[model samples]
Structure formats: C-alpha cells, structure tokens
Target: MNPKKPPVPVPLLMVIGIVAISFSSIFIKWSSAPVSVQGMYRLLFTSLLMLPFARPYSGAACALRLKDWLLLGASGVMLALHFLLWMGSLNYTSVASSTMIMALEPLFIMLGAYILYKERNSASAILGMAIAIFGVVFIGWGDIGLSAENLKGDMLSVGGTVAVAAHLLIGQKLVARMPSYLYSLIVFISAAIVFAVYNLVTSTPFFNYPAREWGIFVLLAVVPTVFGHILFNWLLQYASATTVSMNILGEPVGASILAFLLLGEQLSGLQWAGGVLVMAGLGVYLYSGRRKALKLQDSLPNAS
Candidate 1:
C-alpha cells in the first residue's frame, strides 16, 4: 500500500489566510466609527496582541542597524496611512472596487522601488505599468461619470495602495536583517503611536465606541492583522514567494464574494473590467521580474 500523502501546508495556510483576511473590509464596514478611531484602534489592538509574542524575538532584532529601525518606523507610518485611506474608502465605494484596488499593490510596489531604491525596470515592467495605469484611469473615468464620490473613493484607495506598497518595499529591506515577527512588532507599535497621537489631537473618541464596534476591532486585530499575516509569513518558509503572491491575487475574489453574500454589494461592469485588467497587468509584471531575475542568475558563471 502507498503511504499516505503528506499534508500540503502552504496552500492550506494561504487559503485560510485569504478567507480570514477577507473579513477585514467586512468588519470595517460593520463599524460606524470614524476613520481615525477605527484605524488607530486596529493598529493599537493588533500591536498589543502581538507584544507578548514579539518579546521572544525582540533580542534578535537588536542586531538590526539603526537604518533598519528607521526603515521599519517609516513602514509603520505608511501602514497607518494605508489603513486610514483604505478603511475610509469602504464608506464610499463598493467592496469589489476597494478590494480590486488593493490588488494593484504590486504595481505600486514597482513604482515605489523605482523611486526609493532606484531599481531598474524592465521593458515588460514598463508595459505592465502602462496597462495598470490605463486600467485605473478607466475605472476612475467610469466612476466620474457615474458618481464623483466613487471617483474620490477610488482615488483614496489608490493612495492607500501606494502607502502599503511603500510599507512592504521598505520592510523588504529590513527583513533581511531581523525576523519578520520583530519587524512586525516594531512597525505595529510605531503605527499605533502615530495613529494614537493623531486621534488624540483630533479627539476621535476611541473609548466611547459601541461594544459591537469594539468586537469588530478585536476581529480586525486577530483575523487579518495577526492570524492572516502570520500565516502568510510562516508559509513563506515552505513555498516560493512567487506562488504566495499569485495566491494573494485571489483575495479580491474572496472579498468580493463575501461582500455580495453578506453585505449585498455589487460591482459595475466597468469595475469588473478594471479589476481584470489590474490583475492581468500585475501578473505580467511579476512574471517579467521573475524572468529577468532568472536570466541574470543564468548569466552568472558557476563558482570555481
């Protein structure tokens, strides 16, 4: 008899992560609180929940240079900006549009890397960029004709995309030095502090939120912020990053479906088309980068 097949952990974890993270937008929509209140507390609660676990790895993080810490801090602030804008966008647009915009993150990361790290872009990369830009323009154009509020929401979502792409790219630099756990902890703490101070000055009234809103806050912390991210991070050890990234493209589908079933949200034809184009462009962009990397690796002579 053949031995029992081993369990597939990477894809399993990825599916679970996708399902868990799909609730982030749903939870945010369920809340009636202001953006500042939701954004600050989400980070604050996630940070507090992660603190105990991060302690074990904090010592390992000390080996990181000051530049690494600075980068992590910047990433944290960028994360705050993403939450501020993306979470707010849900109020103005359908879940499908917002989640579809989130998938454009890879394209934004390409731009951020070009500007911040001065990374060279391939011809395919440029082509992919053009396509993605056109898709966004198409989406926004349709939104403008339909409702200016939608156009505003799309723009805000795009802004949030840029922020998150910057956060991921910056964190990429630091993760080479320290563990992801510690890096996540520092960034979460820094983001929480930034949001907290902003909220305090703005008087966002974090404590007076209803109990149901508080439960949503906790769900945001545990589901997407902690569990989903941690699962993806862990799966990285078993699967190629490329595979993991491709799987992340499914997030919009999962989220959109949940929105449809649970929130009774629907998307326009333009939004659906834009989502397809954005995802196609991103897939091409990532594939091109991989090809370039492979070609470079092949050109390097074997070591003596």
Candidate 2:
C-alpha cells in the first residue's frame, strides 16, 4: 500500500493566509463607514464571489442535518459579532493594542478545543504559546490605554476575541462534514444576513459610501476573507484549530510592519523586541508540533 498524499500545501497556504489577514486592520482603518456596514458588505461580497465556485458543493448542504445548519448559522453570528467588535475597537484604541488583544485568540481557542474536542497541545507547544503571548504583551504594553474610551475599546476587543473563538469552536465538528468552500459559503452568507439585519435595525445607510470605502470593502472580502480566512477553513480539514490559531499570532507582527510602511505609524524599539519574541515563540511552537507529528507518524506502523 502507498502512503497517503496531503490534500493541500498546508504550510504555504498558512503563510499566505496569515499575510492576507494581516491587511485586515489596515483596510478597516481606511474605512469611514459604520462597522456593521463594513461587515455586511465584506461578507456579502464574499458570498457573491464564492457563489459560483460553491454551487458545485450545493449537494453537500442537503446531506447536512438541522443540527449542522444551526451550527453553521451560529458560527456566522459569532463571526459577525467578532468583526463588529474588533473593527469598532480600532476607532477607540491603537492598532497595536487591538491586535495585541486579538493575539489572545490562541489561548481561548486552546481552551475551547480541549473542552469541546478533548484536544490538548504538547508541553513545548504550550510553552511556546506562553512566550509568544508574553511578547505580544511586551509589544503593546506602552500602547495600552488607560482612558475610559480605550478601556471600552479593549473590552470590545476582548469580546471580539471570544466571539471569534466561539465561531471556530462551533465549526470544528462541522468542517469535517462538508467541503471547506461549501462550509465557508454558508457561514459567510449567514454572517452577511446578520450584518444586514443589524444595519437595517440601526437605520445605517447601505449605499452612501464613496468609491474608496467600497474598494476597501471589496479588498477586505478578497484579501482577508478569501485568501486569509477561507484558507484557514480549508486547513481545518487537515490541522487542528489550535494550530491555525497559533499561526494567527503572526498577524500582529505583520500588521505592525504594514502599519509602519503603509500608514506611516512609528514603531518603537520595544515593539521590535516584542516582534522578535513573537517570532521565536512561534518557531518553538511549530517545532514542537512538527516533532509530535513525526513521532505520531513513526508510531503508526507499530500500531498497525
């Protein structure tokens, strides 16, 4: 018998995903529209772009039971909440602070994975996570605001992190049932609906935005939604959600660099130090994970 081939280039795709998602903060910062409106169109455009490709997977939806549909819908709502909260946070807090808060996602994800799926990381991986988180804190330590508005933004960011974690945890079981694209399509559509409803309730204008804002929306959908998140969703078929979240830790570093270049935001020596620590931690995490995977693979023959 032959060994099984991998379905996709997991590492390459992960890099692409991380890089793509790093732009999210930049695009969100450029937009002057309401957060709900941004999210509505981001997901809406994502759904429309995915529709043609996703139609082939339509039959997969029929095979899903009500529980699965409910899970998908719930995932969407959680995702919507995540965008609304996180994007809203940017208005009141610094990008570094918001992204730092978002870095807490892996810890949230690990806890949820263990609770829901009984998944656990190796000791080394956990240590790496700790190191990376410390780096993130160090980077954002000076930038964290003490003002009431900043506090509100930090709280909102925390909510966004929890929402995203919930979204991933809810989808953990369902991602295995259907194709990744199909799964993403349904979830995106559900999120779009939630955003749409929220916009309607708030009486926010749907079409008053200038061309630049519209471009931002489209870029958000294309870069982050398509190349970033959808790739991670695809990876869910092969890797644990915890692994994906670990990869997401790089987003702050990427975003920070982008901020310096594109937005002309200044980076301090402390930020650079923190960036190095974050990379080192991620290296350790990936090394541990890879070693464990190799050990598991080696043991398969003995078990057989």
Candidate 3:
C-alpha cells in the first residue's frame, strides 16, 4: 500500500485556522480602546509573546540576503498598515460589512499572483473570483446607500484588503527563502516598531485605557494575533497558499455569527445570499488550485 497520507486534509486545517483568525474582528470591535491603540498594543504584545516561542535569533547568525531582508521588512510594514486600516474600519462600519469586504483579499491575491509572478490563472479561478466580487458588491449595496460613515468605513476595509493581499504576495516570495518563524519574527518586530513610533509621535495616550479595555487588548494579543496568526503560518508549511486563501472564506461566516451573538447585529436576506456566493466561489477556487498544485508536484522529479 502507498504510505499513509497525511492525517488532516490541508483544506480542512486551513478552514480551522481562518476560523480562529475570524475572532480578531469581534475582539477589536468589543475592545473600548481607540483603533490605533488597539493596533499598536496587539502588534507589541504579539511580538513580545512570540519571542520566547520563536527564539528567532538562535539561527540569525546566518545572515539573510539584503533582498530577503527588504522583502521581510516590506511585509511587516504592509501588515501594520493593513491592521491600522482594518481595525479603523470597524470603528465606522458594521462588523459584517467590514468582514465581508475584507474577504475579497483572496481575489486580490489571485490577481496579484497572476500579474506579478506570472502565475497561471485557470478560467475556473477567474470565474470564481468574479462570482466572489459580485457577492461582495451585493453585500455592500445597502451600506453603500446608508450613510457617509458606512461608506468611509467600506473604503477603509477595501484598502485593508488590498494591503493584506500585498502582504500575502510578499510572504509567498519571502517564506520560501527563510524559516517561517524567522520571517514572522522579523515582520512582527518591524510592525511593532512602526506602531510604537506612530503612537508616540501622535502622543496617543496608551496608559489611560480602562482596565477592561486593557484586558481586551491583552486577550486580543493572545488569542487572535498569537494563536490565530501563528497557526495560520504553520499551516502554510503543509498547505498551498491557494488552499489557505480558500479557508479564509470562513472568516466572514465566523465573524458574522459572532457579531450576531455578541452584538445582536442582524443580517439581511441579501447579505446572507451574498455570503453563500462568496463561500461557493472560494470552494471552487480552492478545488481548482489544489488540483493544479498536485499535478505540478507529480511532474517534478523525486529525490532518491
């Protein structure tokens, strides 16, 4: 018999990982701190918390190429900006709208991969992305007409999505050349420094937050930033980027459910339908991409 296949399906692991990541938005919304402070502390504590676990310097004596270092730094900066925009969006928009719009990052990733890396995009992948975009449009329609605040939030959410896609593309390039933990450490540290400086320059009062807000901030750092992000990165070792992207479809579902339960946010019929379309599109994209990856792997020569 062929050697036993890996126990867990990659797609399933990715779904679980993304589900954990989905909790992030809810925590951000629940925290009483300002968005910039929330972003700042989340990055700060996550970097600090992960240091003991990653112990990245154990292997840092082997210097990274300048290009690799630049890529890693860029990824961190992009991530910082992504959080700044995404968390800020929550302050102005419905969590549902922000989550749904951010779900489009996968589509942006696909487009970026095709354009920048010349990765082949199958027709099915294009179709799936288009369907998902349509779904996002449908979800945003009501909010589009509602108020300027919602519209501004929607724009910020979209900007965050673009930044996240850029992060993924950069990550795909960098992770291949460095340890995942090391790359994560570099990115987190860089982001933390940037946020810290921004917090200081703006004279944001960090220590003035109420105990409850601080508690939530600490929980946010531990749960979503540490547990969720590290798990997602670890899963990348076993799963293709496209597979992970597919799993991200669950984020909106998880976030929406949490919002409804915790904040009593009601979802309209059109929004639910749109969510289904997004899920279906992601499903199709993953299926097609995984098959392609398997084929490519099979065609490669095996090491003796």
Best of the candidates, TM-score: 2
Clashing pairs for model 3 are none
Which 10 successive residues of model 1 have the least lDDT summed? Answer: 1-10
TM-score for predicted model 1 compared with the true structure? 0.77
Please list the residue runs of candidate 2 whose C-alpha ends up more than 4 Å from where it truly belongs after superposition. Answer: 1-8
Candidate ranking under lDDT, highest first, comes to 2, 3, 1
Residue 62's lDDT in candidate 1: 67
For all the candidates, what are their Cα RMSDs to the real structure?
Answer: 5.7, 2.1, 3.3
lDDT of each: 0.70, 0.87, 0.75
Tens digits of per-residue lDDT, candidate 1, 1-304, equal 0112215634456668878878888998888988878777777888888777776785787677777778878988998998899988988887777776776665666566667667667788667755655554444343343578887888888898788777766666665556767877788888888898888898778687789989888888889878675565444344323333444455676677688789987655775676576557656765775576567567666633
> What does the lDDT read for residue 81 in candidate 3?
90
Which 10 successive residues of model 2 have the least lDDT summed? 1-10
Two-way TM-score contest, 1 vs 3, winner: 3
How much does candidate 2 score in TM-score? 0.96
How many clashing pairs in candidate 3?
A: 0
lDDT score of residue 298 within candidate 1: 71
Can you write out model 2's per-residue Cα lDDT over 1-304, one digit (the tens) per residue?
Answer: 1123356666777778889999999999888999899999999999999888776787898899999999999999999999999999999987888888999999999999998889989899999999999999877887886999999999999999999999888776787778878888999999999998998888999997899999999999999999988888877777778877877688888988898898887778888888888888988998887787778779989996
TM-score of 3: 0.89
**Best candidate (score: lDDT):** 2
Better candidate number, 2 or 3, judged by lDDT: 2
